[model samples]
Target: MGSVAVPSDMPATSSAEPSSGASNSPNSPSAEGSGNAEEEPTATPPSPSDSMAPQGKVTALRLADFKTRWAGGEGWIARTDDSGKSWKSQLEHKHIVNQLFALNNLEVWATLDIGDSKQLKLLHSVDGGAKWAEIGYVPNYSFLHFVSSEEGFSGNAHTKDGGKTWSKLPQPAVIAGDAYFHDRNNGWAVTQNKDKNTLDIVRTTDGGKTWTTVLKRTTAASVTGTVIRSAGKKDAWVELIGDSGMSQTSYSLFHTMDGGKSWIPVLANNQAGSGPAPGYKTGQESKVPSNTGSSPGALYVVNPKVAFMGGQCMACDLPNTMGKTTDGGKTWINLSSKFPGYGTQLIAAADAEHLWWINTDNAEPSIIYTSTDGGEHWKVTHTFDKPQPTTE
Candidate 1:
């Protein structure tokens, strides 16, 4: 596997409260579901936190599209209503979902797949996802995310919509991977053009009035995937894939705390991709070489001490891939085996003890798993895509 592009985040990036319009159904909390990503009028909500609860309290889980074959996972969104007791799916667009976000419990935005024509699909469900409406269907873009319901943006081909709908930004800052926003004033996105030798990172404040591209760092020197994000305006990180394919080297992963201003390496190897691809694990001993200073393996920080790193145990196997994070990508550790299959389907920390991992395995629906003890154990909380038809 040459490299992998993965998107990792703790949760909501804005301070706005989610909207509440829809009520929960008597669906009987099926152990398998995707958490509601908004504060709908239907249930109570959890207190705001800088980071998500690491125990993976995802009350619900669902696929991007059940009508089509898997693989075109446009994006996802989550919200905890009723004090994390249940979740609701907020998107019902006919096209693919690119990015799902909650400006607040009531205010939510999801960028769906707008075809190459001017018939784009920009969905907004004021009723907590039970139903969606095409707020505005503009073309000339395929991917986008919002800093808030009042302001949002995305990037894609300019063939449709005459490129008029999307305000052209400086430089050809086309991105291919993940994007993030600290708030309504600042946001960023990464590009994997390869030939460009740069990771297109863009930020906008004062709503979407303008955009500035940070092309200082390029992906040419990285074998891992790149994502532009900030846990908060004061703290941000540019996480990359920890190599898991060929080398058992722990420091195959890397990240930057200064919002892509600097770069650092970690002994992290992600368990993504296939055939020559690597896999990821969790635990303390399996984290890295157990050295000091910069010799760390992989690091991901939700907050100062509220973090985790890659590690391993006495009877552990490299599995060619795993991840660990310290306070600030410092002390590394390893993850658990609850994450079955590979290829960076999804990675999240709902809280300190709850971690969520969704692997991309077309072979089965058991792609979503969760860890309540930080990464010690995992449970197949849900399965997606439904089993396919077989020959008699």
Candidate 2:
């Protein structure tokens, strides 16, 4: 089933999306919206000497009938080039492109935040994801992307851009978390500012123009979100925080082959190198929920010796579950429970068994699921609708 393939070059970053509760510490009060349970999943399948039913290659499979006026929230595009069966829906005004980038199949890049004029609402399509054009205006920020197409970048506390023009981001990397690039003249970003309380890190190799802080430590490692790109440079992944300098309790888990200058911490809790991957639940709540790419521990580790992560059980979302590792992260498995959902924001995979996910229909109309034969099975299609009201 592997067919949608071509062009394996990538790089560029400045992605962010931190606004649910900031970090839940104003006094540690955040239920995010009141009634919870929308996404959180776990799964582990595709074994038996490795099943052969999974024929890969299927990017962005949407069937969303269409509806708006405020539904749920979270939008990501898809692509199909005579491969993965057949699918397309570039644009009609579904500006939620869940921070997307296709770079191949034709050309695509997305990001949105308008009205109060948060600025920067890019949407390009040479014709792949379909058709989209907004081109300029970028301010404020919540999440950004673009690892190709004139090269792009954006951040939360600082850093900003649009590519050939429209500026900001050219001095001591202020604060950013999860920006990626292995091409576009090399790229990398992971930050947490605050030099007074102690916790400063900065890096940028000419992409943003200038800056280098290295690592200053009040204890460092304290980012709750950002870093979930799937464009080579080795399929970037993020979600770090494992302190014990003695303030809280973290296990510290990270992975960045070479695109982030330097970072190495596969997994920890003092290390789980033995055996036991969720299957029945044993110790430390069966740990291993790393990679806070947001949207419920986001995942898409590309091919780190075979890996694919997912979560949704903040006390149960909808049975939301998915997880797998082919010896890279040491070992893991727990995928296949049907369709339990509580909170699973976004996840995308093409091979290993054609998989894609989108959850959190809290307000309703926000569900999209697809799996070809891996993860056992998953086929919802679409139900998106929340932005159709302008009778002025």
Candidate 3:
């Protein structure tokens, strides 16, 4: 089953202390000497091996493996420094970690879902998960997006001083859900106006100080937009989920070039006139019905023109289809025959050529597959085993 982008279904305990070391103190000596430190006594700025040298390489990607299904379960965050060659778990928690935002190897943020309570706990690890500090809590939030170590947005709240403090941004007429920040100042967010019962896409150019609605649902369907991925301030993709209650759930893919001012439907199923036009069927077999249970599964946008789209079967057991577009979304070449299994749960693109996908099949163990030449060839990089509890 497709995982929901909500809080986990388990309870989370604050494993680490309340950040009492000098690291968490903003007025500590480290903060004062951070940017204002003078040259050393030898008239040379500290050497590369000096004690003040930066720690660790930039973390390329982080993966959270939950011991159980979608909800509350034991999980750990694994970090890979040299692409996906080797990995090590940096943080182990007693609860399910739904999302992770890694600014670097040492600075990361995670959202822990405390099941049943419908609450969320935000944790921050500055020492590469060696120690975690409870940053904040929210009743509900979709995911966390960090543009930098100091700036991030979750739900409708923004954190400027890392995760030490947060401020609620003014909401539009609708209640905001998922959010994405491409940079420190430019971003996009999804909102739903409960009073009007409509979904809207909003943009922020000056951080979260101001916002403007660029796309709104004009149809009667209850639409929810979840940001799939973004390449920059202008190029981004969003998955629109239309819930008709008793009717079958509808999925459509939309892309925006001029920020959120305008959007074009690149691929959709069963929803007519939603965008350009419905593309080819994304099921395993041609006779399985086009776009019946398909949704935007994994999306990797290399730029405004080159992008890869993976179609997922949200409500059915049909296999997924893969496609790539070189001329933006105008024309797509189906590449489903290039892979062996269904589409992946997540897609991480190191560049236009190097990509990674996590395959979670019901009958087999979850495995990490890598494709260095786009999607032409694939190799198994890692396979997940049952997690064993580790002593902190």
Candidate 4:
């Protein structure tokens, strides 16, 4: 009852289209809806460089139906009780598994990369993974939130005790994107201002030292990415990726009950302000169907109104679906076209009807879909094996 933090693919900030002086009005200024200071506050735009680079691949998390845990290719880490048929490894490092976490089943965590070298590290496992240790070195594309087993967070660094020790988080996160806390003092993030290109949705009660900017956006679109999901205390769900020119690639889902202060636009392009959240309405927004290529793909929320999303663009060859929004997100449904082609790379929801999907799009036997009626129905709960390929 404490393992949920697996929405990868962050690093977004691009928007140079909606202009004519811009003001698509979701609150306009491009988009803004923070506490309000009577508008007008734009100037600090720069110092925003990009490139976090993790993207190793393959990630998984499933709490029951036999338990589960997985990391990516090279760095490895595995587990499966029966639901996935079989698996065991638990740890084998060199550099790959960019992110993975499982705060419950005995606690587990991972982050190890090598691509750009920056040489990252931070791996731990209480027991569910059998064994794993190396708990230090982080920050290269940081985005981890531990919650227990010693407290955590790795980006702005702050460890209560676990990762051996660490500290320094005075407000400045967005090592590219992605961050969710819900415990050590609430949280929410999706930042990137790179000098006004815009993309913000920040909040922090006290844990992050400071931050406040309920929502803001103006990335126009060229190629963007972001993913966030939350459940209890004020709900949360954000999945954005733009770039709707010719090559397509569009997606924008936003929801935040009260936690982030304000934001509602279930799936948008411009629903004005969209509806539902304390209260909001205009058109009702629902437009996520562009070329579908950029890839931000995957969301899991299971509280303030169920959730489960999917993704795949494989360069826009398309043919990948899985969406289910009980009512909170306003609307959504397309539970994978009756199980066809399998795509949704990762999702885990142990409640609100139970769910668990992980289809590595064929990275050596990966499919493991399962559902308990929240996704309308799903099957195919068996298949595993994916780490074991290191030749270097």
Instruction: Identify the candidate with maximal lDDT.
Output: 4
User: Between which residue pairs do clashes occur in model 3?
Assistant: 9-71, 9-72, 9-115, 10-72, 10-115
Each candidate's TM vs. the true structure? 0.52, 0.28, 0.64, 0.31
How high is the CA lDDT of each candidate model?
Answer: 0.39, 0.41, 0.50, 0.53
Residue 253 CA displacement from its true place in model 4, Å:
2.3
Report how far residue 318 has shifted in candidate 1, in Å.
12
The number of residue pairs in model 3 that clash at the backbone is: 5
Give candidate 1 misplaced runs (Cα > 4 Å): 1-8, 13-94, 114-120, 137-144, 155-166, 171-225, 240-263, 267-322, 342-344, 385-392
Please give, for residues 1-392, the per-residue lDDT of candidate 3 as tens digits: 11111111110111111112222233322212121111111223333532221112121234222111111124555555433434545555666666666554466677776774655778887786657788776445655666556666665566777766767665454544466655556667767666535667778888677888887764444554454566556766766665433223355566788787677666554533232112223231212122322455556565666777665553444344456666656656655422223424656553445555664554344555555555554545555543343559
Give the candidate order by descending lDDT: 4, 3, 2, 1
Better of 2 and 4 by TM-score: 4
lDDT of 2 by residue, 1-392 (tens): 11122112121111122112122334433322232222213333334542221111211222111110011123434433321222233343534433555544455556554444556466666654446677765454544444445545554223223343555444344444445433343344555555323443444556556646544434323444344343444334444433332212233334544554554434433223321211112244434444321123445654545556665444344445566655555555556443434434556554455555655534344455555444454545443543333358
TM-score of predicted structure 2:
0.28
Rank by TM-score (best first): 3, 1, 4, 2
Candidate 4 vs. true structure, TM-score: 0.31
RMSD of 2: 19.0
Instruction: Give lDDT tens digits, candidate 4, residues 143-185.
Output: 5656556777655566787777776565554533546655566
Candidate 2 lDDT (Cα, 0 to 1): 0.41
